[model samples]
Target: MSGNFKMLAKTLYGFEPILAKELRNLGAGNVEEGVRNVTFDGDTGFLYKANLCLRTALKIMKPISRFRVFSEKELYRQVYDIDWSDLFDHDKTFAIDTTMNSEVFNNSLFVSQRAKDAIVDKFRATTRQRPNVNTHDPDIRINIHLYKNSCTVSLDSSGTSLHQRGYRISTNIAPINEVLAAGLLLTSGWNGTTDFLDPMCGSGTFLIEAAMIACNVPANINRSSYSFMHWNDFDDELYEKIIAASLNKTREFHHKIIGYDKAPSATRKAQENVDNANLSEYITIERKDFFRTEKPVDTKLHMVFNPPYGERLQIDVEDFYAKIGNTLKQNYPGTNAWLITSNLEALKYVGLRPSRKIKAFNGKLESRLVKYEMYEGSKKAKYKTDTQ
Candidate 1:
């Protein structure tokens, strides 16, 4: 393996440990968990593998340079010191994204502009032509992180965010992000041992992610592009070998993965997305109101879903949540049901005391991932309330 370098994988809140564990399992060296990112050492092939297989990662970045800067001039000098031509050609278009948490840099846009100037100047001095900056779509995407007086410049190896797995061409209203979906499933400890279900399976994100986890399928198997592919040092043969090896590691899944949605359009979209992900063999979607359905499986089932949170969909939040509780208590037995919702007021109407409640965020909204365990042959779940 050539070009063994340190890479940082960014993830959502409460997922650092899982991301670190995943990196270690993937044979990454020096796997260290940061606030919302994981740092690891891997070669180019390993980078491709990480981007393709990491379910919880939102982006994988390859750091090219690091320096200290107390002022704008120092920042420009530091940015210019790096050999930009070594990373990409002058013919390519590039964009700079900056994240600043420092006293020296006031505005991230200004920092990006300075960084861009340094790179363009370097390119012009070397090749007599500078790469144009394309903010929307760029051949090379550079990331600048300024913490206090220290700065880290990295190449965005996963160009368009790993969440765009390329399989979800169709989506229903309030469709969850693929990376978030995978992280939530991982957090719930879904390991393919039990049957899986997503009652309000809008676009079947949970079902598809669950099936992939159960079958040991790579997370970004359907994704076609990566930022590293445009890098100057990219090796086609090595990347192809990594893909082939990853595909070879996919295992068999036995348990059933089911999805139910009240809306026929949602069910159809989920089915189409599932089929697009090549997971139709492991997942099944049906148009049925979850409130009207019973536990389909005889064995212990693991259920996870995101119900209508009253933000996007128009529904009586109180009644909808109460019905969810009623359905689980009356029909679902021998099941571990987990749901994420931001509607705190509606959660009270569920009429169930969650056995476990984990604080989480659905995008910017503060949310809770509550769990309800319904024992076998028991009419009431662990968290039944008399309010119903």
Candidate 2:
């Protein structure tokens, strides 16, 4: 809790730049991008703000110590030397999550176990009582990262992943991760300048995220808790002030954010999620087949969605994906459409080349985020040539 301290915001594989930009926009100093994380300088207040505002970030970690390690004994000794009681009480529960990229540490589980043992042993030696491990829902979450034999111990300020924005309780067959949805929207340049649409919106994830972006709402405004709240130095008043200041930054959104789905159940659940997010005013959900309908608005439109990749859902992958392209080419004019899908082979049948193709991951599946530019008369020219 110094005036300014170094912090890291972890994100997805290709989201370092977006997260870095977010940190800088949030007034972070010395913002530098790493593999899947961004290092920056921010005070405790900024830490709370980052956790509240950053949409692309997965976790915000505060480094406590970093040291060189060779074997298990050294790891245990180093971990045991830390003053654990200064952070939290013995009555609280904690958990360690280890990520090892070193040849010395063959197993991440063993490293986590060794670190846990050292922490519990240190507590026992000091207070004759030790905190129990709560792997599922820990009061305090510790992060251990070992790369090329150098180990860094950090406290996970975000107890759960930031993607858990606490707004989505009802989900359809396959819902996109909230963080991924936000990152993709940001990458597609959805800054709320124009109208937004998620044509195949399932449960309205993209629609809600779009509404929040349009309104400049804090990403975690609906969330009520974080790991930092469990720390011994937790400041309730400071957090309240932070939340108040963040709420002050929200602005009114004039444009509409719309969602459409063929299934009635999907539309119903999407409206429920929209209500959960408190964004019903800015968003609208409808039950309609995208391929059978024309553009809802006459002005320029921005679209982002994650269609079924045929991984968990049963469908004709080629036909489904081709219909997406066909519908857009025929009906959606003057629109910038972006879609993410892991079905690479099926993507070939879309009958249009993507203007931009970015590699991304939907959970463990490797996916591509592609953009299609639909001009006012591009489809007419294609049909005219065929008729000739």
Candidate 3:
């Protein structure tokens, strides 16, 4: 067994705890949570497993060096001291991303530029040839974090964000990030046990992510690319073994996973993406208006989705939200519905108060993930007072 090394997995707001939990469940050691990242320890194989299985991680970073920097010269020298040539080949491509939270550095782009120059100079001096810099898509992506005088450099193991699961080629008007979708599902206490639905559906992100979680499938099982694959120390056999072991652990899901969208275009796109994930058998996408339809199943239903936050949908936000509450209260019962939206004002018109409200961010918009419960068998659903 290779010895353990420290790593960090970045995530969205309010997701640190879930990411930490995911890391612990994946056998990571000393798991700790940060502002938007979780720190943990694992070996190389564990790293591969993390990249493959973590549903909430945006990217897994392997910190290689940490030092105190005082000046640009020292920064260049320190960055250049690393053995870049040993990490990847001279023919490979690379890109540097810098995050500065200190007064010592003003511009992140400048810092990234300095680091990139150091890497290029290091390669030229050592191997008489330098790797090309490809920002859009690179073989290796490097990250630099600066906090006051402390600087740490790490490698981005997952080239594209884990949200880019590679299965979502067909997108709708508003598609939730895959990692964020999975995290929201977990937060709503969704597993593979009960029926699930995405009323608005969009591109069926929640449906696909929920199905994967239900079956214990690796989040990135459908993705074929990773920056680690280009690393000099990458072991193809070890990765294959990890994939096989992960696939073996997948459990069977028995509950119904359905999606409903009023727009036929959305239903078509959702079905296309579901097929891409090879989950068409488990998820059913229907071109039906949720407000006019009743729950397809008689059992308990768990629903989570991202409603149009008044950005793309040209309708009265307040009236639309009110209709949502009325539909659930009148038509759907024995259901737990969770929705995320940036329009806080529209929530008040819903009439029924949310049982739970959690702060979350849908991209740049500060939003709330609210839950409403519709009781079964004629017991009037109680409304919580809208406390804006």
Candidate 4:
């Protein structure tokens, strides 16, 4: 616990490499990428900094114990062997979340229940007291991962998901997740060099994320709570120092970050969220139809948006996507347009060859983040010769 130890940062699908890059950039040691997670070595202060600054990570966990187990009895014994009371107080309410891919364990809930019992029994035997289990909200979160016959027990240093940046108080029907929005913005190579836009922005998620990335702001600077704060060995002064250091690293962003939503309610909510994030000085929300409007700036524009996926919002998918292509090709030139949509069929209706397409997921729906580079000159003019 005192020296450098390994930790894992969980992320969304296809974001492992970027998350790893973030960890390495933050001075993490021995960084390695997994399927949907990245493993790195860091001390306690670095652990706090990782939670504070990582943009693509959903959760940061520190593994405490690793062993091999075959039977349920062995699992309980392995869990009981650890001194749980030393890690957290007996009064601190805790919950166990188990994820497994093994033939021995048929149910994850049963595993969690057994592990919880083991922890309780161990505490009762040693301290003559046990902590209560709070499923909805817990002071301490324990994660159990079993792969094949090997098991690793981890402490979830992040209380809730990092996506809850504690900035948004209002949201539309289909608001994008903050972490995903940031990851998408990074994927599009947006660095605050030029103007940024999120046309059809819902609740201004992409707008806020873009602004944060542009200024090098820590991802969870607004968040106040974490599961690590409840640990017995927690150092409040160290955490505060980490926060101050992270805040000191933020740089100035001169470019503008803009969002457009035709719905009045969406624009209002977006403005409220921007104010909540304290980034109103850098972002602007407007209620304007994207198709009817031209580019707001003449400089190179970077665009990333999560358009309507036709899940709940009813509209002509073909026509809406076609208009997007037409508007980008005609109205919005000199822009690197990127959009994510689960509707694979509707992508063809856009009628433009994508410069790049990356696989991604919006919740459970399979999606693609496609990029269309609208050159400076007119796309039609480039092709029109003597045919006119």
Best by lDDT: 4
RMSD of each: 3.4, 3.2, 3.3, 2.7
* Angstrom error at residue 38, model 4: 0.5
Writing each residue's lDDT as its tens digit, candidate 2 over 1-388 gives 6699999999998999999999999999999999999999999999999999999999999999899999999999999998999989999899999998997988999999999999999999999999999999999999999998899999999999999999998998879999999999999999998888899999999999988888889999999899999988888899899999988999898787989999999999999999999999999899999989898998899999998888898989889888999998889998999999999998898998899999999999999999999987866796787799
List TM-scores for all candidates, in order: 0.96, 0.96, 0.96, 0.97
Q: Write candidate 4's Cα lDDT for 313-368 as tens digits.
A: 99899999999999998888889999999999999999999999999998899999
The residue ranges of model 1 lying beyond 4 angstroms of the native Cα positions read 1-3, 379-388
For model 3, what is the error of residue 345's alpha carbon versus the real structure, in angstroms, after optimal superposition? 0.7
User: Where does candidate 4 have its weakest 10-residue lDDT segment?
Assistant: 378-387
Q: Which is superior by TM-score, 1 or 4?
A: 4
- Candidate that scores best on TM-score: 4
Write down the lDDT of every candidate, Cα atoms only. Answer: 0.90, 0.93, 0.92, 0.94
- Superposed on all Cα atoms, model 1 deviates from the true structure by an RMSD in Å of 3.4
Clash count for candidate 3 is 0
Per-residue C-alpha lDDT of model 1 across residues 79-156, encoded as one tens digit per residue: 998888888888888999999899887899999999899999988888898999999999889999999988999999
lDDT for model 1, on a 0 to 1 scale? 0.90
Judged by TM-score relative to the true structure, which candidate is superior, 2 or 4?
4
Clashes of 4: 0
